[model samples]
Target: MGSNRTNFRVIGLFLLLISMLLFAGGCNNKNNVLSAKQLTDNTPLTVKVLDVGQGDAILIRGGGQVILIDTGDVPDRDKLVSFLKSEKITTIDKLIITHPHADHLGGFAALVGQFAIKQIIDSGQITTTALFRQYLTAAQKKQIAFTVASEGDQFDLGSGILLRVLAPGKPLLTGTDSDLNNNSIVLRLTFGKFSMLFAGDAEQVEETQILKKYSREMKSTVLKVGHHGSRTSSSLPFLAAVAPEAAVISVGLNNDYHHPHPSILKRYEKQKTTVFRTDLHGTVTIAINGENYTIMREKGENAK
Candidate 1:
């Protein structure tokens, strides 16, 4: 009788262990797969790379949050405000000014009162430009929380989406033609299996630094071409490290500086990267659903 009881107890314990393993397996499977309905739900992460001529302005909306990256040039102030209004964006949860460049943050002062801004993020680097000071003064007057971004800083945009800073390391880099450009806030946003890198005017030095520190994390689905696809920004090593499937260059049509140098275009073509330019494709929008994403353009042929 005693032996029989011991045998029964052992068998029951074994069954319990098997049941636990099966339950864990089921949970893993559920997490690994998503139904078509879930993937095609009404809400999906949307990133709008606004066509602010010769400047950078990207609007990201997801998980009940809205983030504005840059404000573009002074002339784009009305355009940016109108676009935000059209989207029914009453408040900006996070406003990231990559740098103080006129074409990047020039419209910031004018936009200070446009939206109910929660926080303002800037690269710690300082400049004496009048535009920069104006932006700073406006932020102060508004009493918006200011944050200086650093490498490894992460901003949670909910729904498992995270924006991580990869550049402007501590102590600030120097010796570059434009330290502000090189120190631009480099951010990488990841949503499930999808990822996009916003390389804010980062040049070779900044790229090399980031590569040395975060080589594994550099690969992304989309890349915002640095410095409007300037030869000085996207070096061969940088391109190899990023390995972006798609590239977007925010440049004006037929403006001075002859932006998006032909050689740079050739480099992207060699990599077989689908290149889209703001000049060519106005306001490129990428709607992300789980690991899948759809790229839409406002206008023009998809090109260099």
Candidate 2:
């Protein structure tokens, strides 16, 4: 009789363990992408468009969390690490890789060596470069929770800041000149009355599709000019839909590609949008407290 009672107790505990496992899984599947559980303290939302010349490396801080989107190029990895260290950022709550391009994913090696990245959100686009292979291997070695962002995926970055993936849905953009760049992950970060559109090198091809789908929802206070303001991006329709009060172009000062192309610059000028370039501004900082916001350049005149 004692033996039977012992068996019964074991069965009950097994059931309880299973129940806990199921509950935990359900919670994890809720968002499925990013993770930030801390509540807000009503502090200002700040995004530093780091001047990682010729590439993108944005530092988003808010809701008691530090998130990095894109990590410049191979040549700029050490610079990125130094800048983050200066800001006292050691643990990255989330690291977002817009796509697997050399200029975007090259800094992963440096980041992995320095920061304790809790989670990683990627575009899931494959590339056949040595750098790309190393990127995947490193992620596996780090054992970080990796997620492939899809359209309509919404992640709460605490403090009521909501980031919505707006592009790179199923059957990723193909048959393009540069499918990698065209299918780059496009994210719209919304917080209170301020919003910013981040299209990681998404050229006109992808822009057309996104504009058609999220046109009504694309209006933002700031637009991170696509493809570093190359002529291939910043389509007229896209610019009109976003209609941002300020636009930031992340590019090198004397890049061979001649980024922030004269033609694209004219478009921003025609729209009467205030332009901020990391090359000239040093590091562009955008601060938002509830409904009011300000754009302060690190060196150039602080903008509104």
Candidate 3:
């Protein structure tokens, strides 16, 4: 854990250099541009898409930071905390809440009592949910730094691991059917040649907005499928733009919403992109070493 904090300042400085380099070409946001002296290449990066039952709970470890994208639903909060303990994760450096939805932000309060949370980043979409208030209070009590995800804003998650925010910028959308869903935090995390795009329940509206703003920068190695594979997301154009070699869908078995729609599966197949579903595959894990990467599942064999 100490080594993880060692590169925080160096990475921050490197990120500033990257920002300045990208300033002239604002949209050319390269996910991985760390110099050899900066990256801890010997320490492989791993991303775990935990099986949280109908919700998103992604754990990204390596480069000295333990980052959690979204917690599972409230009912599964204990499972989440127990899993972290089992992994020996005593602290979470970054806990990013994609939106204010119950499923996405549910386990926040639980982790507050269980772990040392260093900082929190959320969509900042105001909602009158008790769970939301609970997380706010927890952050306040703990005095953890809180940030609202913004388009083009990037954070260095220690040791040259870059978390680039791609959507939910200023002038938030309004009068939408699900303003929350459309304004969810969309993040592109990068380490060396590996990159995973975490689209937090972002629907077609948000997808379209990202495509328009970051078409060239959207290509990634893996994509965390948006809206639990709802028909409202993964628009063909958007898919074409990102062109992730593999896609992971976090959905529960026999879920009420019937997520990871059959049509979306067909689209993934059409694009020759292998799809992994938490309901069918259990926990899906991706390990990255330099330019090589492998995806494994808890219930099934390893995927290419």
Candidate 4:
């Protein structure tokens, strides 16, 4: 009887050890599954066009670099910051002011205060408006590396991603009658066979200038519709020149500017290009890999 009791105790102890091992193995398996999911979800390149409503703010992530183009107006600063945080961006490699327009540069002051800015690029034309002056002051105090980007200037951010300046061949005279919208900085970004054009509030005059200077069609896979799709921009000739598969217009809903004019919308339809609008869809993100591109809207579904 003593031998039997001792054997029974040993068996119970073995069973407990097996149960503990099973529990630990189950936990480890669960952890491994979660890690695999996370690895699959992370994207290599992401372009997020934040919705500031009637303003422009686009974030580009590629080749281990982050580039921010135009912060929206003042009221949208918090939202922009939140979006950056959500994306796990700790510093800005490049900050580009497309133009001196209030809507484009209004949030720069706040952004400079919030994050580490490595460099800044602008048209380098000072403005008389207080908001514009504030942006200049903040940039100066931060001692952010500054440069005036001209047509043809190119830089590589990583993974074969290239940003090429495409507008404002020369600085415009300050306080001149020439429309600021026409002087807006245009950028063309290319990754492999996919490319996108960001025309910052540029109007017909600027488009005409680009056409004359380049003497080539502005072909891109995606086109950020100019002047928020106003009738003043996105000329039919320019549209034909680009021949993009997709177009995005960043504008406000019910804005007084009457942006995304019906005429412009009809023109895009005529070309059979898919159109996305921030005014109606909120933030729009475009992800490109090699020759493939995918678009995701904040309010709508993703399209590839």
Taking all chains together, each candidate's TM-score versus the true structure is 0.86, 0.84, 0.84, 0.83
lDDT of 3: 0.87
Total backbone collisions for each predicted model = 0, 0, 1, 0
lDDT of 2 by residue, 1-304 (tens): 9999999999999999999998888666521211222213344688889898899999989888898989999999999999999989889998999998878887999999989999999998998899999988998998999999989998898889988999887779899988999888999999887899998999999999898889999999899889999999999999999998889988888998999899899899898888999988988877777566667777876222
Cα lDDT of model 4 by residue, 58-155, tens digit: 99988899999999887788888888888777799999998888788888877888899999999766679999878778888889899888887898
Error of 2 at 278 (Å): 0.8
**Which pairs of residues collide in candidate 3?**
4-64
Off-target runs (Cα >4 Å) in candidate 2 are: 1-43, 301-304
The candidate 3 region of ten consecutive residues with least summed lDDT is: 27-36
lDDT (Cα, 0-100) at 156 in candidate 2: 92
Displacement of the residue 25 alpha carbon in candidate 4, Å: 44
What are the Cα lDDT values of the candidates? 0.88, 0.87, 0.87, 0.82
Pairs that collide in candidate 2 are: none
Off by over 4 Å in 4: 1-42, 171-178, 215-217, 301-304
Q: What root-mean-square deviation over C-alphas does model 1 reach?
A: 12.2
TM-score ranking, best first: 1, 2, 3, 4
Tens digit per residue, CA lDDT, model 1, 1-304: 9999999999999999999998888556622433344444354698889999999999999878999999999988898999999998899999999988999997787678778999999998788898888888888989999999999999998999899999889879988888989999999999988899999999999999999999999999899999998888889988998898888899988869788989999999999888989998999987787667767789988795
Best by lDDT: 1
